[model samples]
Target chain A: AQRVTQPEKLLSVFKGAPVELKCNYSYSGSPELFWYVQYSRQRLQLLLRHISRESIKGFTADLNKGETSFHLKKPFAQEEDSAMYYCALSYSGGGADGLTFGKGTHLIIQP
Target chain B: DAGVTQSPTHLIKTRGQHVTLRCSPISGHKSVSWYQQVLGQGPQFIFQYYEKEERGRGNFPDRFSARQFPNYSSELNVNALLLGDSALYLCASSFGTASYEQYFGPGTRLTVT
Candidate 1:
């Protein structure tokens, strides 16, 4: 079965400090990876996808197939960057085989 | 264009009761997927519908059912609901299967007591 894992339940980082939200997925072959974010009182939204290879909100994630991971990284954490981050894996199939999401990590940027 | 939308932003029901949730996909989107998100957990896949047909289903019980319409709208029905059903129900829409990424709605907060 396919699965996504986010080992950290909660992570605290001071402003301007580097931050990394760990994410690992279990899937066969090359898989699409994504990072979604949900701010307090806000709906979940797409932050970035590995296919695009583009950075959003200064956050970037590289799909490391060798490590079976796609960890979210940011050079300098900001107060506004604090939110719930989820790592998801998409399966290329028809039917209700939607994206498999991780348990999510609560990133708290301490001021 | 408007993003995906879901009705009944908040709902509260007692155990054993029934509840129905609705979702409208973004214009031009032919696929709609449903998920259940409990507090402090990621959303779990529930169902997927495309072109008014059931494409995929998750590891849910028969009590959980859903259908899509010709207009790309969808409804999720939960019969004999249980307390564990309390969670946020999110609806996502996409153009087609495969490489197309999904866009999500605000989600409906369902609370079963």
Candidate 2:
């Protein structure tokens, strides 16, 4: 079974400081990973996907196949960036395809 | 154009009762997926429908069911709801079944009493 793990339940960092949201996955085949963010009382929104390799909101995530990790990183965090982050793995099996998500990590960027 | 829309922003029901939640995918999007988010937890995929057919279903039991309409809109129905079923139900839409990037709608918060 494929699974995504986000070890940190909450991470607090000062504004303008670097931020890294850790994510690791367990899958045997080629994997597609993504990071999704949810603002307070808002729906989850896709932040970035490893396939795109495009940066969004100054955040980037590189999928390391060796480490089986796709950690989200930003050089300088902003107050508005505070939100809940989830790591997702795309799973395709037996005609059933869906995303398996981590428990989620709450990020707090303090000014 | 409007984004994905979910009806009844909030709902309350009792144990053993049944409830239905509706969602309309963004225009031109043929795929709709349902997720359940427990308090303080990430959303769990429940069902995915494309072109009026069931494409995917999660580990949820048979008490949960869903269907897609010709217009691409979808509805999730829960039978014999339990208190543990309380959570925010989110609807996600993608251009196709293979489209990995999904757009999510403001979830309908279901509180089972």
Candidate 3:
């Protein structure tokens, strides 16, 4: 079975500081990776996907097939960047099957 | 366009009772997926429906069932609710069965007492 692991339950960072949210997965084959974010009082939304290879809101995650990791990072964190981040994996490239999600990390950006 | 929408933003049910949650996908969307999110945990996949057919299902118990309507809306029925069933239920929708992007609804907070 595929499982996603996000080691950190909470991460606190100062404004403008670099941020990294660790994520690892256990999957037998290549899987599609994604980062989903949920802001306070807002619904969950997609932040980035590995296949796209494009940064969103200064956040980027690279899928490391060798290590089975897909860590989310940002060079400069803003106060508004604080949110709950979940790392998810989908066995099917197109997400037809469904996703296995990590417990999630609560990121707090202190001004 | 409106994102996915769920009904009865919140619900309270007694143990052993049955409850139904509704979801309406965004305009033109044809696939809907259901998830259960307990406090302090990420959402867990429950079921996925496309074109009114069950396309995917998670390891949830048989008490949990779902169906999609011809108009693309969906409903999740939970039977014999337990205290552990109290959580936020999120509904997501995409354009097709294979679409990678899914729009999420606000979610329904179900409390089983």
Q: Which candidate ranks first by lDDT, i.e. highest?
A: 3
Deviating ranges (above 4 Å) for candidate 3: none
Per-residue lDDT of model 2, residues A27-110, tens digit only: 999878889999998778988889889999999999999999999999999999999999998867313477889999999999
Per-residue C-alpha lDDT of model 1 across residues B15-39, encoded as one tens digit per residue: 9999999999999999899999999
The top-ranked prediction according to TM-score is 3
Q: Whose TM-score is higher: candidate 2's or candidate 3's?
A: 3
Of 1 and 2, the candidate ahead on DockQ is: 1
Fold similarity of candidate 3's chain A to the true chain A, as a TM-score: 0.97
Model 1 lDDT, residue B46, Cα: 92
lDDT of 1 by residue, A2-110 (tens): 8999999999999999999999999896678889999998778889989889989999999899999999999999999999999988776422577789999999999
Could you tell me the lDDT of residue A86 within candidate 1?
A: 92
Q: How many Å off is the CA of A47 in candidate 3?
A: 0.4
lDDT of 2 at A49: 86
Native contact share for candidate 1: 0.63
Instruction: For each candidate in the order shown, give its overall lDDT on alpha carbons.
Output: 0.90, 0.91, 0.93
Q: List model 3 lDDT by residue over A1-111, tens digit each.
A: 999999999999999999999999999988899999999999999899999999999999999999999999999999999999999988877666888889999999999
Winner on DockQ (1 vs 3): 3
lDDT of 2 by residue, B14-112 (tens): 999999999999889999999999997788989999899998889999999999999999999999999999999999998887636589999999999
**Which parts of model 1 have CA positions greater than 4 angstroms off?**
A93-96, B98-100
